[model samples]
Target chain A: MTTPTPRANSGPSGTSDAPAVPAVPGPLAALPDADPAARERLHARLVDGAERAGLLDVAYRTLETPVGPLLLAATEEGLVRIAYGVQDHDAVLADLAERVSPRVLRGPARLEQTVRQLDEYFAGRRTRFELPLDLRLSTGFRREVITRLPDIGYGRTESYARMAAAAGSPRAVRAVGTACATNPLPLVLPCHRVVRSDGSAGGYAGGAEAKRTLLTLEAA
Target chain B: MALRPFEEIVTEYGPMVLRVCRAVVGPHDAEDAWSETFLAALRAYPELPEDARIEAWLVTIAHRKAIDVVRADSRRPLAVAEVPEPAVGGSGTGGPGAPAASANGQAQQPPWERDEELWDALKALPRRQRAAVAYHYLAGLPYREIAAVTGVSTDAARRAASDGITSLRRSLPGRTEQRTDAGARQRRAHQREERGERP
Candidate 1:
């Protein structure tokens, strides 16, 4: 199948060229279709500095992935955000300020339960999360994409065509891919579990290597 | 090294950050998390080393801010009790949660039940595990970074995440049953409504 053209607003390079759009967050453009484990390692390394800088909360994670640490964060009302990569420091923070709230603070004093819960998860003790999420950041089709992502089974993978079918539009496979690409919260929504019908690893917003790593980890 | 004011950073990466936040928390909470992340970034930016990578720094802040939001929000009662079965929102679904089945007026299932179930599943995992799952599965973080964020050794983090997945897999059967039961009930309710009878 012919590759879908990048979004109209994207630059000639297919990366967002808006002067304000700093280097497209992660190594999305530079990625090559390859092994999952290495990509996971790279994804892990990329986000270290950001986590240390206190830009990330280091909570709300899933176990053993191909990519580096999974940091899921949110607003007081619900999950409003998530982040990846070591270099995502400013990017993650910038997103929160622009989307979640201006009253942000560092104290887990507020996210006490979430922190505790995350601690429990990493300990290999807990399985699921029980948190409220504020989904104000998504709307229209995007919201639909996230809301529907959870329907994918754990361990099992689906193709874009199958995913589109599950999402209720057999014809909108490309749109579903876009949704996956644009997904804000990848794991919680379980986007990595998605693959091409031919079993080829598809594109991921977090980077293809990261995606491969996640798929491998899941397989492991 | 001192970093540029967060405002400058936000102006530059606002949309990307919001996309990340939105990916994790959904749309409704993104605004608040976004605000919190940037504000926190602003307060902490000055302390960052000059050689610091701004993008990573911001992502770290955003992740923390997002956790704060999830924690606080978890305190409130969830709107629904059942977690949705994990389904690919597929490109056909108009994104992830597009009202696909309902869009073409196909056999409509209650989206609320699925939403509740999915949220509960994510919330059910411990924070680190949840984050790992979120990153690898959702945000697509690798084991190494997941280790860094959660303060575990890379292997430990990988194990923790794998363990978490195992747990999800183990629990998924049970959750699927519950979800199925819930879906059946909803379908019955719809049927009841169609019959035009209310007790």
Candidate 2:
């Protein structure tokens, strides 16, 4: 594939002998021996630079999932990312990288196994995601809300107010609405299973249609 | 129920916008800036034309916030220079007047410097060009998104990035030189690690 022209501002010209990086527009691969701190610092510069330029829509990636593809988006700040795949791959990925964090990489290798397990679940062979996810995206409240969800057992659902009360914000039905709205990682956390107090679908970041489809699949 | 403009925008553009904020400001500031940027967008949504690029518009707002932070940081007071005693209150014995002070009596300490030539080179770019480079190269905005945000045609955004690159090339040091120096440093660090390992 033809490489995109190197940005004239590319980091210092190393020996021309070094293999030129190809412009394959997949998830960013790991940098060799990457210092996590340096990577974070450099990513911050990029995010800051982009912010200074006033470009906000975050960029994200779609990992193939059993129910469907999963979207994972993050900001350059920390890993408190969001996931909402099952539609519009290009737009979602672009938004994630641009707005969330340009330092996006493929999800941990274990996610692939998780994806497989999810596929098996859809195939009626497995039931839960056992892979390690970098759930650094959720806040304490959101995390508490979501963490309570997977324990919600497959084929079951909970009400928003109940989730709020369960998360120790018993007076926060509105707050529950917000927590669901801002659920960084959606399906993995199964925010879709959270419904309105009236037992109707309240809202979902991935569109109500997708949410319904997911709920239906789980119910099946 | 129809998605509110705020929800729609957040669903559509939240991650990328947050990324940009996270990049420039820290993670802490990113959420506030993100909330503000969209809140502003929501208020202005009705005014947007159908042809208007919403993502571009959102990004431009985020950039403004980043610039505001930068400008605010610039306003902090400089540390007072500890100038040597003005000998006027001193005995005539030529006591060490501390290090020599400038004619204005400020201490001659090395100008508190960032020595950030690379950052300086980036800063030297024209505003739009610089923005284009930062967004495209660093923030990794595609040309189309960059175009959408800058209110420029896509081709124009591409050119801005290209031109910004050209300008930065002229201003910044060569990449090859950096690679060489980095290689040397890596080698030294490796050698030191090896020496420690040998024991």
Write model 1 residue lDDT over B19-86, tens digit each, in one string.
Answer: 45654564345545655666566556556776865545666777788888877768967741232222
i-RMS for every candidate: 20.2, 17.4
> Using lDDT as the measure, which candidate wins?
2
lDDT for A211 in candidate 2 is 78
User: Which ranges in model 2 have alpha carbons more than 4 Å from their true place?
Assistant: A1-68, A72-82, A85-101, A106-110, B1-199
For candidate 1, the per-residue lDDT at B81 reads 26
Error of 2 at A130 (Å): 1.2
True contacts kept of 2: 0.02
Cα error, residue B96 of model 1, in Å, equals: 46
lDDT value, candidate 1, whole model: 0.51
Estimate, for each residue in B118-155, the C-alpha lDDT of model 2 and write its tens digit.
44565566777766755654345556667777779877
lDDT of 2 at A215: 80
The candidates' DockQ values read 0.01, 0.03
